[model samples]
Target: MASAPVIISAHLSIPDAELVERFVRASGAGGQNVNKVSTAVELRFDVAGSPSLPEPLRSRLLARRDRRMTGEGVLVIDAQRFRTQDRNRDDARERLAAFIQESLSVPKPRVATKPSYGAKLRRLDEKKGRAQIKRGRTTRNWE
Candidate 1:
């Protein structure tokens, strides 16, 4: 809704409708307030069910082993640090944005490299030194 959800990275995108979840008071702590108000934000993002997300991205998201992600591919982000519901809600949104941004980042391609001549020589030298040390420990025979 707000400028197509600020694209934090290349592959991440937050849709307007998906960000509508609200904050409620989390269970435990603030004995009275816990029972009275729902201040903890419980962000529920259906990664598997979201129609807007691309298939590859959806699969990648579901494959992640995040504690918040349920077996059914629903991500439940909880933000209860802040006392007010609005702050907690904002925090949850921020975290969700971060997750999406990280997920979208492209990893560097690995390049295969062979051992350098100098490195190989050093390794051989070390092996020779070990062999020489072992030889020195053997009993010497004098005729």
Candidate 2:
């Protein structure tokens, strides 16, 4: 309950109770701050067990191929791109919101189509031209 709820979309918001954030020492590019302070934020959300998410969204999030997903279905996001604790913390929450939002959108199914007759003929013509060029490169006795 440290901050406002994570807004995934206009209709969906995940409360702070559903999210867990831990501060850790960042690896690089923060000067002495990297060595002393725990600026990196590790945010965790249970995609499978959370009551906040709808079933379809939860399933879609779980089905995602991201390596961040744990075997227990927790989505862990690590944010250390900033040098400050507040910045990194916000980044982690923002990333989580964006991820959840991404799962909400369902892509339209792709409709397969055959190449046009003209396109097929053009491809064949290009292949013939290349073959003709290759044929000209052969060494002939010419005797």
Candidate 3:
């Protein structure tokens, strides 16, 4: 089973336990029910105070240009798409899980490679063919 997100080693890590934070009603739609119910969830994650992640990963996580990340290195993901609080809360948790998974992924290193000999020859041949076609289209002023 997939684990939930966890905080470790100044970085965020995926954990079996859920780490989704929630809040009550605040601003925005809901009408009269908004005042009575706490349907909004404020998912809070500390990217700089986790033990599961290494220093480098933590720094990278904090440096991400996500609008959800706060100035204090805390990530606040708000989920209110659903009318019910529980669904919204679950959605927020899923979002957190997805983000952590993405952060944990190691990118493939790019290896520099020179153009193949056949490819270079093909390009030259195409250029030569184009030149010949253009030359044939010109008027024979010399004649």
Of the candidates shown, which would achieve the greatest lDDT relative to the real structure?
A: 2
Deviation in Å, model 2, residue 26 alpha carbon: 1.2
lDDT tens per residue, model 1, 41-107: 8878888898767787777788888998998888888899877887887788788878866666456
Q: Lowest-scoring 10 consecutive residues by lDDT in candidate 1?
A: 1-10
Q: Candidate 3: deviation at residue 75, Å?
A: 1.3
Off by more than 4 A, model 3: 1-31, 34-36, 124-143
> What local lDDT score does residue 33 receive in model 3, on the 0 to 100 scale?
83
Residue 109, candidate 2: alpha-carbon lDDT? 90
Task: Give candidate 2 regions above 4 Å deviation.
Answer: none
- Candidate 1 Cα misplacement greater than 4 A, ranges: 1-13, 19-23, 27-31, 124-143
Q: 1-143, model 3: which lDDT tens digit per residue?
A: 34444433244445644344757785688799888888888978777765655777778788789999989888789888888977887788778767766766666889999999999999999999999999999898776
Candidate 2 versus the native: TM-score? Answer: 0.88
Tens digits of per-residue lDDT for model 2, 1-143: 37999888888999998898999999978678789999999999998999999999898998889999998999999999998889998999999998888889887899999999999999999999999999999989978
Q: Give lDDT per model, in order.
A: 0.77, 0.92, 0.74
Clashes of each: 7, 0, 9
